[model samples]
Target: MTLDLSALPPRRGRLAARPPAVPPGPPGAPGLRRLGLDPERDGLVLLPDGPGPFPLVVMLHGAGGVADGAVRLIAAAAERHGAAILAPESRDPRSWDLVRGGRCGPDVAFLDRALAATFAWLPVRAERIALAGFSDGGSYALSLGLANGDLFAAVLAFSPGFVAPPDYVGSPLVVVTHGSEDAVLPVTSCGRRVAASLDHAGYRLAYHEFAGGHVVPPDLADAALAAFLAD
Candidate 1:
C-alpha cells in the first residue's frame, strides 16, 4: 500500500463549537450523573440552591486520579459563595492531553461538551466563568483557557509545568500556586517558568509559592476559589 500523508487533513486546533441546545436538568435530578458522549467518565456539577446566575469554575483533575478531595472542598466552598463547580475527567484515563501531547486534542472537545452541558443545565454567570486545574491538568487548563479566553474569564493553574497552545485569544485573569517543596513537578522549573511566560505575555496573574510538597493546601484552595470568584 502506498502512503499518502498529504491526503490527510492538517492537524490544527479546532474552534470551539456550540453543543446541541437542551433544557436544564430535572429539578431533582442527581447532582452527579453519567451523561455526554463519553459515558464511562462522569462529571460533577453542583448548582447553587437558590435562584441565581452564579459564577462557575470548570476544574480539571490531576494526572492519575478522578476528581480529588480538593475538588469536593472547592465545591463546598463554591456553594457557600453561590458559585457552581463542574469537574470532568480526561478522555485519557491516565493523564490530560496537554501532558501527553503538546497541544490540545480530544480533551478540549470533551471540555467544550462539558461546558455546554453546564450552561444548559445551570444558571451560570457567563461573565465570571473560570477554568481551574492542578498538576498536569493545570498545564492543560492554562493552555485551553488561554486559547479560549473569550469564553473563560479567568484561569486557576496549580503547579502547572508549561502552557503550550497553537494559538492565543483574549486575556483572561490568571492565578497560579506552587509549593516550593514540590518534588513531583518542582517549583523552580515548572511553576516559575509558566508564571514568567504568562507575565511576559502581558497576562494579569496572581502567583503564590507555599512551603509544602505535591499537595493542595486547604487555605490555598480557598485563595484560588476566592480569586476565581472575585469581581
Candidate 2:
C-alpha cells in the first residue's frame, strides 16, 4: 500500500503522504527548532546529530501538553538511537482532535504538513518511522498509526485511553505501556482494554503494565524505542 497524497480521499483519519526524498541542501542542523508552519500553535522537530537517513519518531503530547514536554519524554532515548523527533501541537488547546471530538481532522492535516516539511529538511529512514505518545496522545497515536500503518512502521502508545481507528491499513508493530496505579486513565479500562482490542483484531502487540501513575518512565521509554527501532 503506497502513499499518494493526491489520490487520497477526504477522510478525517487517513494520511496520504509518504516519506519524500530529502531535498538538496546543507545537512539539517542538529538540536530542536520550531517548524514555523503555524503562527499560533507551531510544532517542534529535534534533529539528530550526524549522518543521513536517521530514524524518525513522531511524538504526540498528552492532554493540555505542548511540543516541548512531548519531545522531552523521548529526547534522551531518541538521542541514543540517533533518531529525529517531530512533535506537533494540537489544533485544539486541550487535546488531540480524535481524542476530544471523536474524529480526526485538523490535527491529521497539520501533522501531514509537519512531516512533509521534516522530510524535505532531513534524511529520514522510511522504514523506521514510528508514532508515539502519552495518555490522550497515546490513544490518538494508536488511532492514526493503525489508519496509516503503511507510513508508520511501529506504534508506541504509553498509557493510552482507548483505540478507535478510522480504518486499519497495514500491520505495524504495536507497543502499549500503562501504569498500574494510573488514576487519570486506569490500566484496566484504558491500556489493557486497548491492548486486548488490538490483539483480538489480530495486530502484533506488546503490552507492559508498570507500577506507577500516569507517566512514561525513562526505562520504559528506552525499551519502547529499542523495540520500535529493532530489526
Q: Per-residue lDDT of 1-231 in model 2, one digit per residue for the tens?
A: 635443444385877556666433435668899999889888899988886688899999999999999999999999998888999999998999998888888888888878877787777889999999999999999999999899999999999999999998999999999999999999999988999999999988989999999999999999999999984
Q: Candidate 1's residue-wise lDDT over 82-129, tens digit each?
A: 777788888888888768876567776676666766666576666788
Relative to the true structure, candidate 2 reaches a TM of 0.93
- Candidate 2 Cα outliers beyond 4 Å, as residue runs: 1-12, 21-26
Among residues 3 or more apart in sequence or in different chains, the pairs in candidate 1 whose N, CA or C atoms overlap within 3 Å are: none
Per-residue lDDT of 200 in model 2: 96
What is the C-alpha RMSD, rounded to one decimal, of candidate 2? 3.0
Tally clashes: model 1: 0
Question: What 10-residue stretch in candidate 1 is worst by lDDT?
Answer: 2-11
TM-scores of all models?
0.85, 0.93
Question: Which stretches of model 1 miss by more than 4 angstroms?
Answer: 1-37, 68-70
